[model samples]
Target: MTASSYPVLPDERLAAGVARLAVRHQGRYSVETVQRLIADSYEQLAANAHVRTHLVVLAERFAAERLDALAHIESPTGGERPRVLFVCSHNAGRSQMAAALLAHRAGDDVIVSSAGTHPSGAVDPHVVQALTEAGVALDEVYPKPLTDEIVQAADIVITMGCGDACPVVPGHRYLDWPVPDPDGAPIAVVRSIRDALDARITALLDTLPGA
Candidate 1:
């Protein structure tokens, strides 16, 4: 709940994330405030990791995005909320989780799409189980490959381990979540990854400029 309660991180890692946030948001937020904000953000996503790699990076990103939203930042989309595309190696796992989570949480506030660089035959059974457990139905959704049209239209492109195969449109807001491939991971691991996505997605929706 407070910065002092932030999940423990290595001193250098914590300070780096804090300083990055403070400097990037220098004009709008003070260094002291950004430090607290980054710590709080780290706390928000800390519980979900089965292993705590890259928590600081994700936290800094989530914190900075929220701070931008608090300032009512505008984007290339102008008055409209963003349309986000989630891409991964296959549409079966991480991308599917992200798409479902964002849709469930954001509703009509944000448009959501997802695709894979190399399409699989169907959505992974475990991914479906995870979504069903969360009460978000997208059973009809299947593995689909990325398309230029969707990529061009998206206001934000979020790649979850898609690597070089992900499309790059010059004007879009591109972000790589660096989420691991969830293909063979256990249900518990999948859920933990889902929680991370929830943190990032919520922060993203919060940052969307309204129509």
Candidate 2:
């Protein structure tokens, strides 16, 4: 009846090793029960990259649960729509593109977010240009670190190239798209990346609920 019973714990150091798990989740974890569950999940699945990834997913679920408990929060209730997260190593290129593309295409129907494993301070200008050329406004996009709350908030976590650096949470789906980095690439290449992502996002949209 607890998160600890789910699996065996990993070494404590692994928790520090896998730090790029969350995106921008703002949920607070003050409850002893929630902490226990997180710790238990972390310990049980410490050695498994996939299990750790599930832990990241669990973080999002917890965030949703926390939000549901708040009477003043304006977030939609469960099953209204699913949250999606896009992750890359820098949060500067591919992940940013994918997140923006999804948000643009999906609009308010889906919650979308993006982050980097080793996040740069700002998005790549080339990425900005590519998105702009693709017709998605780029004025409000900013680079952010991967965080536990963000991971916990997402129903889907898309990893670009972070591999094991991302975390795992149970009961969530994951997708990995091997998109190339467009930081310094020529406009042609950036456009290619954009087109590829657009196709992928279209396909992904087909999988979302009520799509």
lDDT value, residue 78 of candidate 2: 63
Reference-based TM-score of each model? 0.61, 0.64
Error of 1 at 12 (Å): 63
Q: After superposition, how far is residue 119 of candidate 2 from its true place, in Å?
A: 0.4
Error of 1 at 52 (Å): 40
lDDT of 2 at 102: 91
RMSD (Å) of each candidate, 1 decimal: 15.7, 10.6
Over 66-145, each residue of candidate 1 has an lDDT whose tens digit, in order, gives 56545543333356667788999878899989999988888788867887887665677788887888798773655555
Candidate 1 clashing pairs, residues 3+ apart or interchain:
none
Q: Assess each prediction's global lDDT (C-alpha) against the native.
A: 0.73, 0.67
